[model samples]
Target chain A: MGNLRERLKAFYADYSFYILPVMKFALALGIYVLINNRLGYMEALNRLFILVILAAISAILPFNATVMIGIALIVAHCFGLGVETGLFALVLYVVLVLLYFRFVPRDALVMLMTPVAGILHMEAVVPLCLGLVRGPESALSAACGLVSWQFVEIVHDEIAPLKEADAGMLNVLQSIPASLFSPKLLLCVIASAAATVLVALIVRHMTTYTRLRAVIAGAVLYLVIMLAGGVAVGVELNAPAIVAGTAASAAVALFLNMFVYSVDYRQSRFIQFEDDDYYYYVKAIPKMRAGGAKPVRYYDDSSRQNGTGTPVNGQDVDGVDFKTKLEDSLKDL
Target chain B: MLTKQRLQLMISLADFKQSHINTTMRVTKYYRNDYVAVQLVKNFFVTSIAYLILLGFFAVYHLDFLLTNMNNLKMGRLAAVLLIIYLVMLAVYSVITYVIARIRYARAREKAEDYDQKLDLLANIYREEKQSSGNPFGEDQ
Candidate 1:
């Protein structure tokens, strides 16, 4: 197991330079597809060749720049739906960005996770991941992301219903309040995300089984909150779909923890040492070993064989012990 | 060709750079320990306020439905139950954060102290070396 892990780590280190760019490109493509499918705005812009080119370009850009492009695409989609919708989205996003900069500018990942959560339908994974890799303060960023996602979703839904109707500025503006105050949508998004964050925060701090257990607990909490909130808001529940989605999300979360945040539980060490003036107590935690190639050992047969078939010290040639023979050879030299 | 003013300016610049590095290190240390707790508290308040505002917006806009729901005793009971759950969650979360923060702070302080001791030892060694070499800086004095 250790050898395999070492080999895996070595392989990752060797190929990460290539892998990262590929992953980025793939992620960009996925984001483009998601937005195009979700909004169908800019049908002309959604040509396969253009999307591929844009994805490639996005891959080379910095992460924040990529996110900006993605946001721009979403806004373009909103504009395709209606000018009022697009303007409202732009204003909302500007506000979100300002809040992000003013409070937690470092949490760009959480901000990105907003649209991802909506598209993936796995909002629980965001908090689970953040709790593992970041501090508790990341919850604020997650909340902001959820709100942004909900806002966009509300706008999309409202515009969808009025697609055939005359979607003038006034009509679009009139529909905003209904979408904004839709108790079911707000409650489900907010409550589920908040519950997941709370679950992740508490479970991740536990001494034993932190990441895996947090993922499980977080997924459960998210489902419970979503279901309960749905009930409270009089929304019909889809039990089977929710169960399947939560299960798949938990599995993905587990896989991510294994590959990204794996730790060796057995290699933990506690040491006590003393210097001239102070006693030092240390707890050493070992990270998971990456899989690597097994070491090969070579032996020289001529050294063990002294011109005679019999081995050194009268031991049989076939059963000659290497350590004893080497020691004898060294002593003789 | 180097003037005294240029030398003095160079020395002051070096001093300023060194002080800046030291301040950065100190700030990083504080952030890794004490600032975590502060950030958690701040996040809690900000997230709570944002949630409340969102919920409040919905309630105000849907005042008729909200008032009708509020008249139901079941709604009050449900709110109370939800509130209790939230309170319990908060309590647990606080304890966990406190414990983790304390451990991290202690570890960081220990590392800082060890680093300081090593630095002091290095300084002592350098001083001894200078004295043994007949004090090159002392020659100017």
Candidate 2:
């Protein structure tokens, strides 16, 4: 595992420029494909060529441009459905943009992550990952993402009725307030914010297996809030899906934590010490390394005179002077 | 004729420039006060436009009731309420933009200072080489 980590690190360091653009392209393509599948109202916009071009452009542009392009695609699809639908989507997106840029401009991707997870029935991963990696402020972005996803779901649900209704502008506009401010959305936003904050808090305070503990706590807290809140609000609860999603989210968070904060807990130690002004207790955990300790051979003048070289266990160092190499290696250290 | 140290410094400088060019260009394009003020005005206009659109939606949603009570409605009070909402939105957005712009400018200034220091170091290296070589342009005569 340590060797794999070292290799991965080296690979990233060597070709990060190419790797980053490839990753951006992949993310952009995935987002565009999902958007087309979920809300492919306009046949022209849904063409493979158009989506690919959009993704390609987003790959080369800044990350925030990708988000903006996604929003534009969603709004375009809404416009294809109906003028009222487009207007509603425009208003909601504008408000979300204002809120996001005004408060958390740095975490633009987080605002998109929640809805994508929701589309995949894995929204729980968002808060868990956010808690593991980001500070408490990220909760706001998660909440915004949840709201956007919930609004999209609402639009999807209301699409048929909207089409059947005669001149649905007034009726649609009237219903917007109630649907957008539903109790379910409120509960979800609260639950997501609470879980993120709690996980971040636990991770901040705890020292041992901090990411692991935080992921578990965040997953549990999110599940509890969602289940309890869903019931109280009379919203039909998908208990199995929620449970499975939370478990999957926890697993994903742990996997990411393994890559980011891999440490040798077996070699961890605690020490107590005192300075002139204060006492301190410190816990130290060794990082995982690709190389184990190399055996250093020491030879005295008497051994050299006897012509008996230092023995290496199960290893060959034939025809090489140990003293010069040892001195050079020590100097490097 | 580049030495190893000089090549390393040049590489570091190039890397820094590549990473910071966008931010450096933006920061240098405008005076600090003008940038922040411009942002504030831009945010104010955006807020005003959004608030107007929201009001239009609200009016459309309540068009039936508003029409029914058209005779009884007080236009002055309604206009005042709308104006108040618009003002509040503008004020909030203005403050947010002000802080964001100031922070962006300060961060850019810090990077610019670091870049300037690197330039100075490179220049000093050239100056030292020229003195040691006893030539005006640090080249063999």
Candidate 3:
């Protein structure tokens, strides 16, 4: 596990700039495919050529700009379905924007995860992961993301109804209350998310447990929450499937935590220092590194040795010796 | 609102607000308890707006149902109840955070005091070594 984590860290450090852009492009493509598959807006918008272009552009653009483009795509798709659907989507978008600015403007990750989690039906993972890695406040953003996912699903549901109904705007608007606010579904999603957040927060505060253990606990808690929440809300759930999916998500979360919060378990050092009147106690945690590397030494052993090859104490080395020592250290590395 | 002085003041105030927000956000890196409180306050306001919007949508579409049920529903009373619930939750969260912060502070103070004692002992040992060697520079010289 340690070796794999080291390799992963090295790989990330070496190619993160390139890997991140490619990952963004892939995420954009995935979103496009999911949206197109669900909405089936227009052939022009759904074209492979257009999606590739959009994904490429989104990958290079700033996160906020990318989110704006995503919003625009959702709007366009909704408009293609019906005017009322478009307006409803606009309202959802406005609410999301308000929530984003007011609470979690920095949380682009949650915004990206919303559609992904919704489509995958692994919504619990978002809250669980956020609670472990982020503060309790991120729970709001995770809930917002889930809500946005539901909003999109609601918009999608409206498409068939809007197409079938030849009635006026009032009649169409009336249909929204039932589809838009299915209290049972909303309750289930919110309850599961809130439960996950609570479990994650509790696990995070368990300083005695390893992060890996905490992540596993979070995943198990998520599964328990979903099962209990589903039963309480009378929501139909494929229990075995959810269990399997959440377990897989938990495994992924554990792997991610390993890379993100890697620490050397054996190398804890305590030291004491003083400056004038004040004293400081420091517990230094040294990160685990690959075995073949060594820290650079700046002082020369030769400079600290006398003419008869005996070690001289408290000898100050000059700049030339220091430069030689640094070069030698670098060469050894 | 469009006056020159007003505009300048508004810009300055906006700048100050932005800087303040940035500083507070950075504080989360060092202080988890404070960040949790800030997040709770922010989430409360944002979620309240979202809930209100959802309610507004439902109320606008189902005006007749709301009107008929108004006597039993008592919207103002419900709002007051929600406000009370929010306040209670906030108070509980604040108290919990305060306790955590106090414990952390106490632990840090204990560590500092321990370090100070160790530092004093080390200083005394160094003084004894120097005196025994009969040189102010000690054995290293």
Candidate 4:
């Protein structure tokens, strides 16, 4: 009974950080489907994959303000769709995020990444793994499983009707000839970008330089690929390519980074880095210091006693005398 | 099920906020020795003023372009409808964060009312001082 209780506790502990985010992801998706039966499948699918992976990361790391923000902002940024489509999506994302850290378990890294994670959804790898994992399963099964979670169920039962009414209200709002753009929308974008920077600053507080470097490198690569694709496809930076390119770039960087780590890590720690059919430059050094590998046999003294050879201390040394000393030290006891 | 963990998490957040504020106060005090603090405040003031001016200026500058864009989109009334919906959503998100943060602050104040481990450490420091010099005050000596 005690063991069973402990198992249950562990299970809850493991998944606590993710439950709310995943549920929110589903709620946002459900609303998307309701609004348009033929919802652009690319962005929603990509977001679904990322949601699962980040869910895993959040589960592993300790919960904190940083991680919560990271988790929330990312889910919102990805699935919220375009700027226009994102308005409602963003609200659901924020509420779910708040509820998670409030009502669920948050890991330490989540706390560190909280600020920027939401707006930017900075971790690019979420989609890559999700693609590899979820692509095999039926979309309906995946969607339903996600939607059935407690948070999604709550939204369906409680929030959906209210939102449906809002949708009707939004329809009425359409009749007005008001400007398409408003300071409100522009401010929101600027605010989100600022939030992205803010979250990144907070992330820098907890994460190491190398990981941070990888993150930035991944970002640049993602943008380049996305821009190239956007130009090629004549689509203005769509979700499918952005997510696909970013995920691919991050995976490549994660692999190549092994080659960039310090030699001491390779030698002492014994973590084998694979770059098959590749050769790397190694600098020859005179001595091993600070966790470096000790040289095999570099300590033989050439100076020895010649009865005439002068020594700084008491004894004089010559070549043969040095050889004798070496031999003597090496002799078996 | 979430009750126990929730309480622990909230208390932890309160502890974190208090320590962070204290650290910020100490660092700011020390940093005041440098002229950077003066520069920082001046820069903040200048930026805020600049942003305020631009906020009004840009509101008028882009107002025409935005309305035209809205008029161009032929999505019936949905386009205009969604814009209002977006504003309402933003308002909701902002209100929720502000209220929760305020509530957390109140909870933090209540948590601080109990005896803190900081007091015990300070008492130890006082005791050590008493041993070095026979009590400095005469009333209880």
Candidate 5:
């Protein structure tokens, strides 16, 4: 595992500049393709050539720009359905944008990912991983994403009926607000929000197998809330689908945690100290390093005496001090 | 003409700017009051626009009912409720923006101070080398 980590790190370090653009391209392509698959109302915009060109351009742009493009595509597709549908989508997207930018400008990706996850039947992963990696505040983005996706579903369901009924624009518009605010969507948003906050709290407070516990607890909470709420709202609950999706989401969360934020619990250290202001009890866990137990940096005693070495609670073993530069850097915070 | 050490320092500084200093630079470019106020105003506009959109939808949805009961409806109470909702939303959004802007400004200022100290240290090194009449690519370097 350590050797594989080292090779991956080296490869990333050497090729990140080239790799990042390619990854962005892939993500853009995936998002565009997913959008087209879900709502291919506009035949012109549904072409692979246009999608490729747009995704390629988005790859070179900032991520938020890509999200904006996604929104535009959604609105365009909604417009292709009807003017009432287009207006409804436009207002919804505008409101979402306002709320998202004001509260969580950094989480546009989450907003984009939610609908995609829904389409993939992996929506549970969005909130679970969000809670594991980010703070409770990310729930806002999750909620927005959930609402956006629910709106998509509402549109999908409504499109066929509206077209068949040959409804007037006013009648179509009147039915929109009702469909958009369905009890099922509300319950799902509540479930997602609750799960996100609960997982973040568990991960933040727990010290042992934090990611594992958080993922499990989050998935369970999400399932319980969704199932109970679905029952109360008279919505047909897909028991097997929900369970399978939750399990898959939990596995994905654990996998992401392993690669991105893993630490060695066995090598954890506890340190207690008091200053004039407060007494601090700190539990420091060592990261899973590519070199295993090797000291991150070495400092001779002379360097300390000369005030050249950073002052830290470094543990010395075998004539080498494991540097705690991270502690030193975070001291001010 | 850049010395090897100076060139290395420049590369490090550029890397820092690219990787870490962008948010700091962007935030610290404005005074604290100016930054926070600007964000608050932006939030106000966004909230207003969103509120108006919601109101439009509500009005449209209830257009028939409202028209039928227009004579029976409490116009003043309805207006007051709408105003209160708008104010509450504006207040919530403004407060969030204010807090976020202040926190960002404080962090940016801290980072800017650290960057300035680093620049000062580099300047001092250049001064010391100049005082000693050292070559640009000295043996010590």
Candidate 6:
């Protein structure tokens, strides 16, 4: 035991930085995957894809609706639904998000969304999905996991039980089932399509709004095709039909975006825009190297300076950073 | 807290030593023991928080699952295996964070050293040029 400990200690002394972090990241991802696979089948793959698109684009869609969704998830579980409350909540969520985007400046929205994406929601994402799909126990556990991606397990289990239960209760579950009269489904489809446009508009305002509204306007116009498809499918404004259609809209959105976000699965590396701000911390290291190694010297009337762009020995050659010294000295002539 | 502050003081002392060429003393000795204790404590915070979230999940699941499943071979065995795996992972993560922090601190010290070295060299050149130029407005001119 003592000999093994000594050997392990020696290995750690050498390659702890690279080896250790990779191991931790692997462990975290492994644990999430293990739990997710076992729980199985979230049922609404189309809707799930739609949700991801909504999430990706809605990252900027200025809707005050975040609070409503936060409230809706809680209320949907609690109230279960009565009359048209499902539709009411769906509309409310949209209005809330729209209000948030309208009232807040774009920069502030980005700032707020950064934390929403980066810190508060980091691992909590999967856990929140678990809460959506699992029992109260699993939901609590998921909340604890925080920023987890373990929803498939919990969702599969929840949907299995709902399958045996009848249709009226499903309507009470809202456009959740995709049948008809699912105000929630109608709302989600409408809002998601609008969000794609709204996001394009907000992004257009970035650095210079190049009036590309024509392209995005064409995309939003495709909702007419979806609406026509819904009518042709003979889906009536009934509870079961609405719930089913809601799920269908999600599926369609997913299918379309599969080509839209369209990442080539072949690429081994993808940059997560989330928490990319910290990327500069590491990036600065290379730039410092690129600027060269030595104290850059030049013929000056008075004193010499270093090349790093910083003053040294409490002295500066004509009040310039050492790195900038050579350039400035050249320009001086 | 005192230990951490002292370790920080030593690191900053190292920082001062590496950055300021006027001080020509050996500082690598003063830092040796103090850093070890600080590194261990820092590792504890990391491992403990990681272990905290995992153990909290188990505690939520049930404390009695351990005693009750002491005999059941399938799920119980899985639970035990996962627990052991998680703890081992925790220790690995703790050590990883420790090393990254160490590398960053060392690299910063290296940058300060490189900077101070350049400044010292430049200062020497200035002193030499001034000596040769004979004070520009003085008797030698």
On TM-score, the candidate that comes out on top is: 5
For candidate 3, the per-residue lDDT at B128 reads 66
True contacts kept of each: 0.00, 0.15, 0.35, 0.00, 0.50, 0.00
RMSD to truth, every model = 14.3, 12.6, 15.7, 25.4, 10.5, 22.7
Predicted complexes: DockQ each: 0.07, 0.12, 0.16, 0.01, 0.30, 0.01
The CAPRI category of model 6 is incorrect
After superposing candidate 5 on the true structure, give the runs of residues whose Cα lies further than 4 Å from its correct spot.
Answer: A205-208, A260-333, B1-11, B20-22, B134-141
Which candidate number would show the highest DockQ if scored against the true structure?
5
User: TM-scores of all models?
Assistant: 0.57, 0.80, 0.58, 0.24, 0.81, 0.26
Using lDDT, give the best candidate's number: 5
lDDT of 1 by residue, A108-133 (tens): 64555666767777656666666666
Q: Could you give candidate 3's per-residue lDDT for residues A1-333 as a string of tens digits?
A: 646656665665556667778978998888877777777675569887888888899899877666776777777887777686677777777777764543346675566567676677666667667766677667667766766677677666664566666656656667765675676457646654664566556665444344566667667766776788788878777899888878777766666565564432233334544434445454434454334233423246664353433222221233235566668779977
lDDT of 4 by residue, B1-141 (tens): 123443333344444444454634433343332434443444344434444443443444455566778757667576577556555544554454445444544444444433245445434554555565676552244
The per-residue C-alpha lDDT of model 5 at residue A221 equals 92
Q: How much is A119 displaced in model 2, in angstroms?
A: 1.3
For candidate 2, write residues A1-333 as lDDT tens digits: 655666665565556567778879899989888887888887789898888888889989999888888888888888877788888888888877764565566677766667778888888888888887788988888888887788777667776367656646667767766787888888888888998999889887545466778888888889999999898889887899989988887887788777654532233334554323355454444443325223434356666567685532222335457687678879987
Q: State which candidate, 1 or 5, has the greater lDDT.
A: 5
Task: Show pairs that collide, candidate 5.
Answer: none
Which of the two, 1 or 6, has more TM-score?
1
Error of 1 at A261 (Å): 2.8
Q: What are the per-residue Cα lDDT tens digits for candidate 6 across A1-333?
A: 323433444454445545445544443333223322333232332233433433433334323233222233322432232333333334333332332222222212221222132222122122222222222233222221211111221123343355446445433333332322244334323433343344344333322222233223323333443355457655333444433443443343333333322211121111221121232111101112222232444445254434433222222234335667668769979
Candidate 2's displacement at residue A177, Å, is: 3.4
For candidate 2 chain A, the 10 contiguous residues with the lowest summed lDDT are A287-296
Q: Order of candidates by TM-score, top first? A: 5, 2, 3, 1, 6, 4
DockQ of candidate 4 against the true complex: 0.01
At residue A164, give the lDDT of candidate 4.
45
Report the C-alpha lDDT of model 2 over B1-141, residue by residue, as the tens digit: 356776556555665665676878787578999989878877877777777777787888789999999999999998898888888878877887888889988888888878788879877887787777778766546
Interface RMSD of 1: 14.3
